[model samples]
Every structure is written in structure tokens, then in C-alpha cells.
Target chain A: MTPQLEIVIIAVIVSAACSVLGVFLILRKMAMMTDAISHTILLGIVVAFFITESLTSPLLIIGAALVGLLTVYLTEALRRTRLMAEDSSIGIVFPFLFSIAIILITKYAGNIHLDVDSVLLGELVFVPFDRLIVLGRDIGAKSLYVMGTILFIDLLYVILFYKELKLVTFDAALAAVLGFSPIAIHYSLMGLVSITAVGAFEAVGSILVIAFMIGPPVSAYMITDKLRNMLILSTLIGIINSIIGYRLSVIFDVAIAGSIATVIGITFLIVFITAPKRGMLTIINSRRRRKIEYAMASLLLHLCNHENTDREEIESNRHSIYQHLNWSKKFLEKILYKALNLNYITLNNEYLKLTPKGREYAIRCYDDIGYSI
Target chain B: MQKHVIEVEDMTVAYEEKPVLWDIDINIPKGVLMAIVGPNGAGKSTLIKAMLNLVKPISGKVLFNGLSYECQRRYIGYVPQRGSVDWDFPTSVLDVVLMGTYGKIGWIKRPGKKEKEKSLDAIKKVGMEEFVDRQISQLSGGQQQRVFLARALVQDADIYFMDEPFQGVDAKTERAIINILKELRLRGKTVIVVHHDLQTVKEYFDWVALLNTKLIQYGKVDEVFTDENLRITYGSTDRVLKGEV
Candidate 1:
């Protein structure tokens, strides 16, 4: 395979692995845990280097994953103490471990190839240079094999335990009563998350790993109202984001990880504004429509209340009705025009009169506001 | 003498250091529609949670059909409060109801055709068949409560535990829920509800358990749901029983 194609393929695999677990993390409200695990796993790599005396030892991945689990375990333990909230506990534990890792690497392994910059801001552009060779024959990028295996594991874990994960994420109390051991499912998921973060850290860096983990899932969340669809859509969004990010980085000669992270943010922004039902624009439009409908109903009800009463002429006068309703003159004019167009009311010599349809609607609105209470 | 379906023996539960349920002992008979009524903060929900082993008790053991909770889990169902879950969780009514079968389907097994049919039937039983495909967030408060009821119904357990099922529901939905509870009793299922409305206690429940951090009285509704026991359970405030009795 071409070097450029290999680079994009590895990026896609990393995105897929991160995004699958991202769905559960977002649903479980543990997105911050991903941030914690990705950073703290650096301590694992530093400590493993100290033990094995080799930067490229396979044990580094295992060590990093173990420390990631340790991060989750410690954070949860602090949360269970009940003195502090989950977020506060995560804030305390994340930095404590991550800083220790940074200090160890700078103090003890400064001359080694394991620089903190490369770990934090992974350069995906150089991924093609690191080839995986088997039996003295060059095969492919090492990241491809690592990320492909992680993605396979993540998919199998989700598929085999789909119902269990859904139950635990949605209603942990129910999952507990049903003898499902929510804690077991919870930690297993965290374990997969840690492993995914560790595998992606070398290729995309810790910061981009978080973007790949949280961005696609949140964007897919806005587009679908089903868990199965959200999972599938999140994977698709991740792949598309990777391709666009790679193309952008190549064109602009920018850092690939930074470009990918930027693309994820832009994609989420677009999804947030334009998604059909749950988007910000749709929500704002619906709210505006409801406000106008409510204003029209209030006007119709006011006319109904005053029609044929002693105050009919004074209260129903369009020229002075805005004052009675405590609305701006322009606002009342807009509402009045909408009401007239809807045929709910008609103006008679500058006095407002309600038609039969208007009177019925007024009564319904009055019942909804007053009688329902 | 009716056989006891569940027995909570000297059960005490505490959060941190403060005790919520204090050395409470109660036994529920088979096939009785019972209500556990108490004032706010009286550990009503905690008691059910402790019995289900969802909360760890400081001291006590609960027996389900003379077995521990783990053994009797398949024969037990639960309906947490309507506000307990996030409704906007991107799932449909049918999917939530299908979760009732997850325990029976066991680990690593997905819900299949039989589970779907059972969930649909339960949805229809609660008069929510029309909304089986609707997203959960679009449901009204009453509809959400019914969906929870349908989820519990699909469990088809011998005993059902519901926490404040009538809360925030309309009068019609309340009536619908009571009818379903009655039907469950007719089918010889033990239904225990943590109820809030005192006026419906005598009319709706066949058995009553008046609790205030401890068991005050438990018996047939006519015998245990008296004004005297209510006053004691509600802390001598006749105001709580002013319109209740």
C-alpha cells in the first residue's frame, strides 16, 4: 500500500476504536474519564520503561493499559468516599498521576526517544516512517496492526455484551437487581477504553485520542434517537472525519493530529447546529414557533373574554389592545396580523371581534392555562 | 395461613453513618397487592432497594421465596421512580420494555423474537402500544410512568416492586395503573408499591405497611390502615390524616 494510503488507514482505524467506546462513555457520563486515562497512562509507559530498560518493549502497552485501569479504579474509589463529587475526584486523581508521569520522564529518561511532546501532541505525519517488519520483511505501519487489533477487540466486546452494556449504562440499579454485576461490566468497559487510548496515543497523541473518542459519539447522539443507530453512525462519522482531516493536513502542511482534532470540532459544531430534530437551530425554531402560537392564543382569548362584555369596545380596540396586554405596539401588531391571517379574528371598525373558530381556540387555550392547574 | 413470598428480617440500612431503615422486619404474603406508605424521607424507597440488594444493608437479610436474592432474581421485577432514568437516552419505548427480559436472557444473549412479542404485549397492556416506536424523550410524565410499568410487566416475575408509580401521572393513567396492578394480583403475582397518595390506600391496596423509619403496622388494609397508626407513623400530625382518613 502507498504511504499516504497507509497513513489514512491507520488514522481511520484509530478513530474507529476510539469512537466505539466513546458512545458508552458519553452515555455513562464518564467522558472525563477518557481524558484522565489517556494522560495518566503516560505514567505507565514511563514506569514500564524503567523496568524493561527499553522504549520499544511490548510490555509498555500492557503497562500503560494497567495504569489506565488504575486511574479509573482510584477515581471511583475517591468518588465512593462521598466527601467529594465525581468530577472533583477525577480532577484530583488525573493530575496527580499524570504529573508524576511527566516528572519521571523528564528527570529519569530525558535522553531516551520517549519525549513528552510526541506523546502529548502525536505527529500522525511521521506514522508512515514507523514500519512493522515480520521476519526481516517490511509489512506495514505498526499503528495499523495495533489499532486494527484494538478495534476488533472493542467491536467484539460491544457485540458480545451489547445488552449488558446497555442495561448498565441506562439503568445500573436494574442491572444490579438482575444479577448482571454492573461494576463488572463498568470496569470491563473502562479497561477497553484504557487499552484503546494506549494504542492510539502513539499514533494520534493523547489530545487527539480524546477528540476521536468523544466527538463522533456526541455528533451521532444529535442525529439518532436509537442506541444501535448511534453506534453505527458514530463509526461512520469518525471515518469521514479522519479522511477530511488528513486531506486538510496535507493541503496546509499542518500537524495531522491537530488538523484531525480541528476537523472533529468543526464536525460537531455543524452537527450541533444542523441536526434535524435535536439541533440547536431546530430547537430555536420550534421555540420561536411556540412563542408566536402562544401570543396568538393569548390575543384570541383576550378578545373572547371582552366580546359582548361591558369592556368589549375598550379592551378589544386594536389601537389600545397592546397596552392592556402589556406588549409592545409592534409585537401586538405582528400577533394581530398572524391572528387575522389564521382567520381566528377579524377587525370591525378598529375593534377586534372573534370568529367561531377564534372563540373555540380561545376557550381551549384558557382551559390549558387555567383549568389544567 | 398464606405463605410469605418475601421476608425482611431485622434489616437495617444506612448511608455513610446515618441510618435510613432501622432494624425493620416485615413479611409479605403471596399474591397480595400491598402498599408501603410513609411520609417523605421515611426510607420507603430505601427499604425496597435494600430488599432487592441494590443497597447494602448494615445488618439484616431478606429472603425471597425462602431463597436469597441472587437465586430468586429471575422471579422478581422492579420499577424505579419515573424520574430515576434519563428519558432522552436515545432509545424507544419498545427497547426500554425489552430490557425486562435481559435478566432472563442471561449474560451475552440478546433479546429475540419471543422477547419482542412479550414486550409488545406488555406495552399493549399499559395502553401504550401506539407509542411503541416513539422515542422515550417525547413521552409525557404519565406516558413515561406507563412505559416503566410495561417494562416491569415484561419481567413476568412472581413479585413486582414499584416505587411511587402514581407520582406525576394524570388521573386516567393512575386508574390505568391500578387496573394493571389488580390484574397482576388476579394472576397470583405479589405486587408491592411504595405509594404516596393516602386517599387511595384503602380503596386500592388489599394490604398496607405503615412505616416511619421503622415498621409501625402491617396487615390487611382495613385493619392496619387506621387513623391511629397513621398518626403515629406521621408523627402525631393529625394534619397528615385530616383528609386522608
Candidate 2:
């Protein structure tokens, strides 16, 4: 396979893995913690590299995951103190670890191939060339195997502890009484998230890793209310963004990761505007439609109360009735025309009369108003 | 003559160095509706947390059914305070209640048909059958409380620990939940509630445990719901109850 194809395939897999776990993290309000893990893992990577003198060592993943778990443990410990809140704990720890990683990188490995830029932004373009050769056969990219393993772990952790994680996220104390240790589940989840970050770091870099982790899931959450559906949708969104991003990069001759992030952002905007039922435009239109319907119903009710009214009297009184409705004249006309087309109301030049359907609709509105009051 | 389901000995809970609840010993009998009442910050909720082993006591042991907490965990159900959870969490009423069956189903096992039946039954028991598919945030405060109660109910535990189940609920929901607690007592399950309302304590609870940084009283309402105990639990002045100052 070509090096570019290898990079695209690895990016797709890593992006999907991060997005799947990202859905839960965003839902649980742990998105920032994932960000924290991604940064702190740099320090762990630097330390592992210093000891092992090899960037390709699996020990880096283990070291990074351990640091991630430690970050969670330390954050919890700090929260126990009345002095510091949760966000502050995260603020204090990640910066310290991250600064240490930068210092170590500049001092020790700056002259070598390992540098800050490679660690922070990652090099997806070069990933395809870093192939794992096994038994004299060129097995795909090494990052693919690493990300794939972490993805499998993430999927297994979520599936195996699905009930426990759901219960604890919803109600931890209740989970405790029901013989499930929510703390245990919480730590395990953070551990898995950390491991995912570590695995995806080499391929996607740190910043793009966070975007991949949170963006697709958040976009999916905006469209669905079900957890299972959210998971599937987020994975699809992630994969779509990855493929689209790679294609966009190829077409525009730009950065692959940047293109991917832009695609995810665009998808979020699209979902925000076009989501069924809860989309911004849908809600606004529904409200406007309701108001117009209300005004038309009120007019029909007024005409029904004053049967056989003169055309002049009804026309002059239209403004008075519209005043009570607080609607624009154009809006009132639109609804009136719609009512006439549906045979809900009959307009004889200026006089308005409610048809059977219009009368029934007005009666339903009256019932609703009565019930609300 | 009822058997003691929970026995806490020399329980001391502290945050950092300062003590929150100190030197507490209490034996609660089974099959009674007991209310843990005290002023704010008196550790009423902490006591339940300690019993469930959610919080580690500075120095003590809490025994359930003559066994350690781990051994007797399956027999206990818990309903935390309303504010303890994020209301906007993406879960339907039925989904939240099905959590009660997680312990029985164990790790790695999903809630199957049996669990669903139990959850639906619990939702019906809580008068929330119509809202089984509604997201928890869409429900009223009282309805959310009912969902949590239903979640605990599906646990089918011998003992239920509820932290402020009536807090922020309407009068109708409060009465409905109390009725359910009474029903649980009838079925031979011990129900413990961390209640705040002193006015309803006498009427709602069959047994009472009053705490004011210490165990002031614990027994049947007729025996322990005295003015002297109230003064200790609510703190000495008694001006609030007397309607003076």
C-alpha cells in the first residue's frame, strides 16, 4: 500500500476509536479531563523515551496510561480538599506535567529526531512509512496496530461495563448501594480513555486527538437522545469526517488533520441546523407556525361569536383583533389565506366565517387554553 | 423483637482532619420506616454513605445482616439525594430504573428481558408507567424523585437507603412516596430515609434516628420522638419549635 493510503486508513481507525469514547466523555462532562490526559501523556511519553531511548516502544503507551490514571487520582485527591475545585485541580496538574515534558524534550531530545513539534502536532503524513515488518512481510502501519488494540479495549470496556457505567454516570450513590462500586467503574473508564489518548497520540497528535475525541460525539449528541444511537452516530460521524477530511486535503493540497477538524466542525453546524425535532430552525419555525395558527384561530373565534357580521364591520375589526394577537398584518394574512384554502374559513370579500373544520379547531384551542389556565 | 439489619459501631467520619460525624453507634431493626433527622451539616446523608460503604469512616465498622458490607451489598438498595445527580443526563425513566438490576445481573451481563420486566414493574409501582420513555430531565422534580425510587425498588433488596427522597417534591409526591415506603415495610424490607422536615417526621416514620454530630436518639417514634430529643437534634435553643424569637 502507498504511504498516503496507510496514513488515511490509520487516521480513520484512530478517529473512530476516539469518537466512540468521546461520546461518553462529553455526555459525562469529562471532555476537559480527556484534554488533560492528552497533554499529560506527553510527559509520560518523554519519560518513557528517556528511559527506553526508543520512540517506538510500547512502554510509552503504558507510561502514558499510567500518568493519565495518576492525573485522575490526583484530581480526585485535590477535590477532597475544600481549597480547590475540580477544574482548578485539572488546571494545576496538566500544565505542570506538560511543562515538564517540554523542558525534557528541549533539554534532552531536542537535537535528536524527537522534538516538541512532532510530539505536539504529530506527523500523520509520515505514519504510513513507519510500517511494522513481521516475518519478512510488510504488515500495515505500526500505529494502526496500536490504535486498533486500544479501540478494541475501548469497545470491550464500554460493552462489558455498560450497565455499571450507565448506572454510575446517572446515579453513583445508588450504584454503590446496589453492590457496584462507582469509583471502580469511574477509574476504569478514565484509564481506558487515557489509554485511548496514548494510542491515538502518535498518529493524530495531541490537539487533533482532543478534537477527534470530543467533536464527533458532541455533534452526535446534538442529534440524538439515545445512548446506543449516540455511539453509532458518533462513530459514523468520525469516520465520515476522517474520509472527507483526507479527500479535502487531497483536493485542496492542505494539511490532512486540519481538513478533518474543519469537516467535523462543518458536520456539527449541519446537524445543529438540520436535526429533526430539536434543530434551531425547526424550533423557530414551529413557534412561528404556532403563533400564526393562534392568530387565525382567534380571528375565526371572533367571527363565530359575531355571526353574519357586515363586511365593513369585520374588516374594520380585523385590526382590533390583530392588536390583541400582537401579530404583523402580513403574518395574519398568510394564516387567513391558509385557513381559506383548507376550507377552515370562508372569506366573502371582507366578511369571514368559520367552516366546520375551523370551528372544531377553534374549540380545541379553547380546550387547551382552559386546561393551561 | 425485630432483627437488626444495620449495626454501626464507633463510626467516625471526617473530611481531612476535622470530624464531620463522630463516635456514632446505632443498631437499626429491620422492616421499619426509619427517618434520619437533624439540622443541616449534621451528617444525615453521610451516615447513609457510611452504611453503604461509599465513604470510609475514620474509625468504625458498619455491619449489614450480621455480615460485612461486601457480603451483604446485594441485599441493599440506595436512593441518593436529588441534587447528587445531573438531571440532564441522557437516560429515560426506564433506563434509570433498570440500573437497579445491575447488581443481580452482575458485571459483563446486560439487563435482559427479566430486568426490563422488573424495571417496568417498578416504574408502574411508582406511578410513572406513562413516563417510562421520557428523558429524566423532562420530568418534574417529584417525578425525578419517583424515578430514583423506582430505580431502588427494582433492586429488590432487603434494605433501602434513601437520602432526602422527599426534598423538593410536591405534597402529593411526598405522600405517594411515603405510601410506597410504608408498602416496603409491609413487605418486610427496612426503609431508611434521610429526611429534613421535622413536622412530618412524627407522621411519616415508624422509627427515628436523631443525629446532631452524635447519636441523640434511636427507637420507635413513640419512645424517641420527644421534645428533649428534638432539642438535641435541632440544637438546644428550641426557639423554632416554640415559635419564639
True contacts kept of each: 0.77, 0.69
- TM-score for chain A of every candidate model? 0.97, 0.85
Instruction: State the TM-score for model 1.
Output: 0.97
Cand. 2 Cα-lDDT = 0.84
Per-model root-mean-square deviation over C-alphas: 1.9, 4.7
Inter-residue clash pairs, candidate 1:
none
- Judge candidate 2 at residue A59 and give its lDDT: 92
- As a whole number from 0 to 100, the lDDT of residue A367 in candidate 2 is 75
Q: Point to the candidate with the largest TM-score.
A: 1
Q: By DockQ thresholds, what CAPRI class is model 2?
A: acceptable
lDDT of 1 by residue, B24-121 (tens): 98989999999999988889999999999989999999999899998899999999988888898989999999999998999998899999999999
> Per-residue alpha-carbon lDDT of model 1 for A1-373, expressed as tens digits?
9989998999999999999899999999999999999999999888999999987788888899889989999988999998899999999999999999989988989898888899999888788888889999999888889889999999999999989999888999889988899999998998889889988998899999999999999999999999999999999999999999999999999998999999999999999999999999999999999999899988888888778889899999989999999999999989988888989998899998999999999898888884242
Clashing pairs in 2: none
Off by over 4 Å in 2: A282-373, B236-245
